[model samples]
Target: MLRLPGFRVASPTTIAEAVAALAEPGARPIAGGTDLLPNLKHRLGAPTVLVQLSRLPLRDVEVRAGALCIGAGAVLADLAEHPLVRAHAPSLARAAGLVAGPTLRNLGTLGGNLHLDTRCRYVNQTPLWREALGGCLKSHGDRCHVVPGGQTCVAALSSDCAPALVALDATLTLHGPAGARTVALADYYCADGTAHTGRAAGELATEIRVPLAPGPRRETYVKWTVRKSIDFPLISIAMRFDLADDAVAAPIVAARVVVGALASTPKLVRKLDALRGQRLDDPATADAIAAQVGAQCKPLPNLPYDADYRRAVLPVHVRRGIAALVAAGENHG
Candidate 1:
């Protein structure tokens, strides 16, 4: 049986104490332990001490200053059902409900999911399995199995909620010994798979804030995975379109599409200005946008799924997601 390496635990009741504890050498912060514990059992990392943040007061979900503020320690299950989230950020709620499974969602925190480690088929194996393969870029070897001879790790970021949050223009609030700072969720991820996120060492994410939409809005999150439940996405897509009014034929005033489970950072599809002023009810509009996604996205063999298959079906999912969103809007209108 796989076992976690020996480690001491520190439970801090205050955010200040939690930040100070995380500043210690070989210390790691943990809340739900859903993601971190599995990696620990796989011998992926062995922190000397675990700084427990469950007791900290960072589990509130409320509206403040026209933005929905969600604490980092808020449970994923709670977020999935929270009225504020369901009403203001339904795409995020759907994505949260779709993470892992019902049991893991009950135990996982939003912070844990947001900072989930980059995953690769090669690196997520047992220590013995990895050792026999001579290791890969993320597992202490110089080479990358996915890219062969590539210097950088190409592990995929498989967070379901990340792309949805990015599409909603969310911001993250981080606290550290220095102080607190807020960063746009879109700007938070980097290209490097080994250290994909911009969160600095000795820092802790406290909350995430999503700005309230200025006008009518419709959004959806869709993903393709090996299984309907408990499997990470092979292709994840989140789309947000602000409408001119709450009418069945409202034109899109702004649009943002983010695709995840591809690389270290979610790909925000660019050149979407053409989507502006297009009505969601128009079938041609969906076809044009899906074509753009298909052209811009090129899936890698970072996960266990076939890259070519993922690439071929990427646009199909986009077109279907648009259709579903349009149908939902029509029903509500």
Candidate 2:
């Protein structure tokens, strides 16, 4: 049986107490424990203490400053069904509903999902499995087996809420001993898989605010996984488009396309400077954009599915996302 290593759980009623607890050495913050517990059982991260976040008052979902402010501890199910989220950012709702299973969704918090760890085939294994192979770059090895002397870990992060939130122009507020600071959600990511989200050692996210886009905006979130439910996505796409008109071939006034689960950091495609204002309804245009998108992603053999298969599916996902958004926008108009 897989057993969690010896650890203590500290429940704090206030955010300051929780932050102080996490500041201790060998201490980690856990909200839903859906992802952290599994890793603990596998001996991947052996922190001596877990600072519980449920007792803190970080579970509210409300509107503030013309944006939907979501506490980090808010459960996925509630967030998915929140009236403000559904009305202002349906893509976030769609992504939240699609997370794992109904049970996990009820238990997992938005903060937990946003800060989920990166996964690699070599690292996410039993101790025995890792011992037999001398592990890999993310675990105990000197070289990355996937890249053969690659300098950095190539784990893939498959968080569903991250991409959708990024597409929505979200901002995250992190609290620690120093105080609280709000930054763009996009700024929370780093290039390294090992340090996927840029939450510092002593800091934890307290809340997120997603600004409402102007009218005539459409968004979509799509997840490609082996199973329909209770499975991590092999790849996921979250997209947003502001349309100039409801007519076919209408130009995109502004756009953001974020691809997740394919790399360490959810990748933001910003090469669309020339492509913006281009008609999104054109199949050929989408294909060309998809082709360009596919060229930028560098998939590695870190996921359960084959790397080549994941690589080949990028364009299909992009095409599908574009088609879905276009249709939805037209209907909205």
Candidate 3:
């Protein structure tokens, strides 16, 4: 049986009180406790204090001033089923629905998913197993076994929400003892896997603000994993496109093709510039554009799948996304 390391747990009713608790040395703020509890059970993390954010008023989802404001404590199921999310950001809604199982989705908060810990097969083992192997960089050792001679950790970022948020150009507000500040969703993640978050240690995510699209834009999220449900994605893609006319054109305006589960952070493939002004109905054009997209992705070998498999499937996902966007555009027209 895995035992959680000893710690003091505090549940605060207000955000201010929670922030104050987190400001204490060796204290960590937990929302949903999905990620932190597992880590604690495996002895991968040992904090002197665990500050729970469940009582904080951070569970609302509403539209305000042309933007969707989702509180950090909002459950994944709530975000997945929210009418605003379905209408405004269907990609995010789809992604949220595809995360874990119904039970987990009901308990896991959006903030917890956003701040999910980086993972690796070698790192997510029992303490005894890790200790027996002399440990990995993300665990107790100084050297990374995954990269051999590499000094930095190479754990894969397995969150399903990151790519969807990045594709939507969402903004996040973080609160702490020093007050609060907002940042672009892209800035939330660091390139390094071991230290993925750029937020201050004592800070907590307050809300996620996603701007409503002008006109009618279409979005979709597709995840390729070994299992249909209750498993992490092997390669997940979220594509958001602002359609113009029957075909995409200039000021086709904004598009984001984000690839997740293949790296330390969800990668943005900006080469999507090739698809601009291209008609999605033309299979030749779509195939050519997808080829270009596949060329830009560089998948590393990790997790349960091979790098080649992930790379090969990249174009297929892009092609399907374009098809969905075109279908949505036609329906709207």
Top TM-score hit: 1
Can you write out model 1's per-residue Cα lDDT over 48-138, one digit (the tens) per residue?
9999988989999999999999999999999999999998999999899999999999988898889999999998889989999998888
User: Residue 129 of candidate 3: its Cα lDDT?
Assistant: 86
| Predicted structure with the largest lDDT when compared to the true one | 1
Q: Which of candidates 1 and 3 is the stronger one according to TM-score? A: 1
Model 1 pairs in collision: none
The Cα local distance difference test for each model comes to: 0.91, 0.85, 0.81
- Candidate 3 ranges with C-alpha deviation above 4 Å: 245-251, 327-333
Q: Candidate 2 — worst ten consecutive residues by lDDT sum?
A: 324-333
lDDT of 2: 0.85
Regions of model 1 farther than 4 Å from truth: 331-333
Residue 42 in candidate 2, Cα distance off native in Å: 0.3
Regions of candidate 2 where Cα sits further than 4 Å from its true position: 245-249, 329-333
How many clashing pairs in candidate 2?
A: 0
- Model 3: per-residue lDDT, tens digit, 61-88? 8999999889999999988989888878
**Taking the tens digit of each residue's C-alpha lDDT, what string does model 2 give over 1-333?**
777899999999998888899999999999999999999899888898999999899998888888989999999999888888888888999899999999999989999999989888887888889889987777877778777889988788889999999888899999989999998988788777777877888898999999977756778898988889999888888888777865646777887888888768888887776666777877776877687779887677888889898899888988987887667645641
What is the TM-score (0 to 1) of candidate 1? 0.98
Error of 1 at 191 (Å): 0.7
